[model samples]
Target: MDARRDAAEDGRETIGISWSSPTRPARRDRRQRPCAVDPVMEIEIVHLDRRHAGLRIADPARLAHLVGSLARHGQQSPVLLVKVEDRTVLVDGYLRVTALTDLGRDLVDAVVLDHVDEVGALLLRHRLQARRSTALEDGWLLIELLEVHHRTQADLATVLQKSTSWVSRRLALARALPALVQEAVRVGSMPPHAAMKFLVPLARANAADCEAVVVALGHQRVTTREIERLYLAWRRGDPEQRARIISNPRLFLKVEAELEVPPVAPDETSALVDDLEGVAGLCRRARKRLRTGVLERASASERAPVAAAWRETREALRTLAARMDAEEFDGRPRDTHRDPAAGQRRPQPSPDREDVEGVTEHRQEDPRGANTRGPTLRSGIEAPAPSDADP
Candidate 1:
């Protein structure tokens, strides 16, 4: 016989026990069995313990209302359970059982069923009830129901009395999301399928950044086009676009500025050129000032002024000639005292700051710090020697 027909036949039998208390019945009374030899699959009321189902029925509001009704009038409907290893297991109406338990009922009505495996029961329960649940919740139920059963989408649709397309679409949406976004969908702030699309951009963002984006999309009533625009920009990885999104107020400001500003006259080209020339002139003056400052600093140094910084061009030429002579020296030790003008080695001076005027000869200072010839003025001004100008 077909399983449904058999279950229906078994369901017609009267278990013949009052659900007033736990010790009311031990086993189903044989007399209340279906009189017909071929029983049809249908559910009937019986006495049974309504715990240990392990499946969560997510309709809390319905359950609470049902509990309140049961509290006043007592259970009128029978929960369905299947026999497993000499123990009865709940197959359907877990919420009803929960409502009855919450109402403090000692015993409740149920139907004894042939053992349908965990998968079949889960699929039946979800199909019968959880279809009314939110997409995210339904997705979780489907996953939980399938984990032990390992049913394909077509099998799920067949057993659950739903279309294969519906099952596939919902499963795809649920599985596409990361855990955190799934939580958001469960909490009902985001639409489950729409939230999947949002994840594409949000995965690139950090937690806080994602929160900001979610808030913006949630609060701004942002259109699909606006969201797509932002998402595409994010994917392009443009720094300027990212900054614009980060500071959205600036985008408004830019638009406002454009609206308020006046257009420039096409014939006023001379003014733009004049402005460019003014900027160029200012840059030129700044360069000149910087060069002059450097020259003054070099000239004031205690050592001889750098040749390049000298005011007279002749001094620069002489400095270049002296550098060339040093670089082109052949087979001779480099003489620091060589004069470029005279082309010969010059006399060395004492370590002390002194000047000697037109003196081609020199006397070395004694260790006692005295020289037989005293210091004399050099060829130039006698105001102070270049080295003596230090202090």
Candidate 2:
């Protein structure tokens, strides 16, 4: 059956339909008929009367596409609006109103709801229609509904046609994430899930560190795995490790190596081999001392410089290791001739018991200024001090 014929047969008149002429302003039909089931009191109103107060974010491409569709085929659905004093605030169909305005249509079809407040309007919009809203947007809306409007999660679930758990999650996300992180998600700097995965845990554990990392790495294009790795490292690493990661992320991220080894001649290779051996021996002695708890007894002032140097050396080793791994994967040999520590002399050995006793006697005699030699170790063993003219 035709719509008009069916309406007539049901003893009701379709008084909502109206038209505007180019020569004159459009007016609403005065004839009003009551609808039984879906009673939508649609009328023609000025496009300017509508005001958007919903949760949908503005998207230009979507609006442009909507405008094209509306221009080809006029607005098929009426936007829901609620009367506020003399103004009509939009409850839904924001895209339609925007499209109508772009097409220079002075009049738009609207269903003017009666006595609905802002909260009611939002609830009605959610209940009557389904729209795509970002998680951040959902969070903001959920916050407003709960905090500003004093609505409960159950109420939100009922109104938005979502589960109670869904509403709870949205509310929690809104409350837990900082405004900056929310803004990052809203501004498309990162995905919502990624922010929840990467930023939330850090922010919960240490907000300052999270903020620092965000400011440092937010602009960089990092993958989810990289972000997770960085988060884990920042959360558990020592001061030096954290500082190194923050200062030189490219190294941890496996970008370009800071130091490159160039091909070396046979003579340079011999020197490089000796330098590597010296470093290995130094590391062995340091490990032995650490195992013996020697550093644990050191004063803070003495340990500070040692810790700093250790961190620096650790970063250098990491960079070198990454470079070696990359070269190995590419089936290329690294050049050992261009060693970073090239030409530097091997460390002098530590003083023996006799030499130490002599140094102690000298210090006792001249406490003001004693020219005592510093100690060193070789391959987990203490060595005697070198003579001044040994070189």
C-alpha lDDT values of all predictions? 0.48, 0.57
lDDT for predicted candidate 2 compared with the true structure: 0.57
Off by over 4 Å in 2: 1-54, 57-78, 85-87, 95-110, 132-136, 157-166, 215-233, 240-391
Q: TM per model? A: 0.35, 0.43
- What does candidate 1's lDDT look like per residue over 129-160, in tens digits? 42355555566666665665576777777777
- Top lDDT prediction, candidate number: 2
For residues 176-241, what per-residue lDDT tens digits would candidate 2 score against the true structure? Answer: 767776666654455566777878877887776666665666655456767777777777889888
Candidate 1 local lDDT, residue 297: 54
Clashing pairs in 2: 262-335
